[model samples]
Target: MNPPPINVQPLDTGTTFRSQAYHALKQAISQMDIYDHNDEIRLEERQLSELLGVSRTPIREALTLLEQEGFIRLQPRRGIFVIRKTKAEIVEMIQVWAALESMAGRMVATQATDEDIRTLWDLFRNFEMRNPKEHVNEYSDANIAFHKSIIRLSGSKLIQEMTDNLFIHIRAIRKLTIGQDNRAERSINDHKEIIKALERRDVDQAEHLIRDHTLGLAAHVEKHCDFLE
Candidate 1:
């Protein structure tokens, strides 16, 4: 099926053309079904220009940023391709993600307000409603939400910014891991325990649980790297 065309808005206030272009392209990648299994999805500069309603200049700039951030590859004599990491690289990145998220959990344990906790509980409720075994996409969304909620609650802007960058790079690995054998169920249970720890405001427990849960993806990806296929 042809992906629906994206309607790019005028640059948001206080943002540069490159920034808006980057955000628009990122949204298109995540929101559209543009990939084919076993084959790299190639995007043309003109197609992106037409879809985003921007000139090729900003498109080139945006693609450059995406390339630098490990999202898309600009191949010479080829085309822009979504980049997938090797199994070992994915495992290493997940470990790095775990360390950052664990620190976020520790910070959020003390900094999160009652409203923040309530929002997290809502995400848990959404996860509970989905059949993890069959609804991998839904489960993945919930899983991302549960962890990202902690990062959002952390008061350190630097931590938030760093994790946001890391999150985008490893999002594919995370989605793939969620599709592994019984992985969604395991992730749901881990979220439950982490939530409980957060509810009790146990900083140590929350940090430890979050770290273990995040690292758990590394194990899953190591065992089932082919899940990405």
Candidate 2:
């Protein structure tokens, strides 16, 4: 039997064509609109290209950049795949994230300007003030913003880059686990404790709080793997 015909189409004409394709693909992957067999998950370049009415060239380029950033993986002859994390992997990453974040927290406690401290406090207060009826997405967004604030205060570009890469995977896992209200509440409390320690300029306490908080989250997530899947 002969193979099916390939459906080739012309590329979109305009400047910013690649940028449009890149943003569309990034948004789709970030929003979990893509998935995989075993019902796992992934973002396919060809599908994205088709959806965005663009050529595969720009789609492939965007995928390549995302892969380099550790958000996706490319398998030889297979296709592009979203980087999925297992329970064990999430646990391990939580430990690393805790260490990195704690280090940032410690630095911020010692070196942060008054303005930095005020910004962080504002973010924390905003998180605390969120209405219970609001969607988990709101809380998740705030959570990311809070961490980004800490990273901004850390003054280490390398640390920021590494943590940003790790958090992409962490954020995906958090999306899986966000349905657990207990976990969400616990995470909020954890952030509070870390902030309190920072407020005191207690580096040791800040580090300990951050690590223990993350370990607690890992434990909570492990006990509720059903929510993760």
Q: What local distance difference test score does each model get?
A: 0.75, 0.68
Off by over 4 Å in 2: 1-28, 31-38, 50-54, 68-70, 75-79, 124-135, 179-181, 226-229
Number of clashes recorded per candidate: 0, 1
Which residue pairs collide in model 2, if any?
Answer: 36-41
Query: Predicted candidate 1: what Cα RMSD to the true structure?
Result: 3.1
What are the RMSDs of all candidates, in order?
3.1, 6.4
lDDT tens digits, residue span 14-40, model 1: 657677889888766654333224555
The C-alpha stretches of model 1 lying farther than 4 A from their native spots are 1-15, 30-36, 127-131, 226-229
Q: Largest lDDT belongs to which candidate? A: 1
Per-residue lDDT tens digits for candidate 2, residues 34-148, read 2112344545566667766777888888777777776788998876667767777777888888788778878888988767676766654655566522556777677667777
Worst 10 residues of 2 by lDDT: 1-10
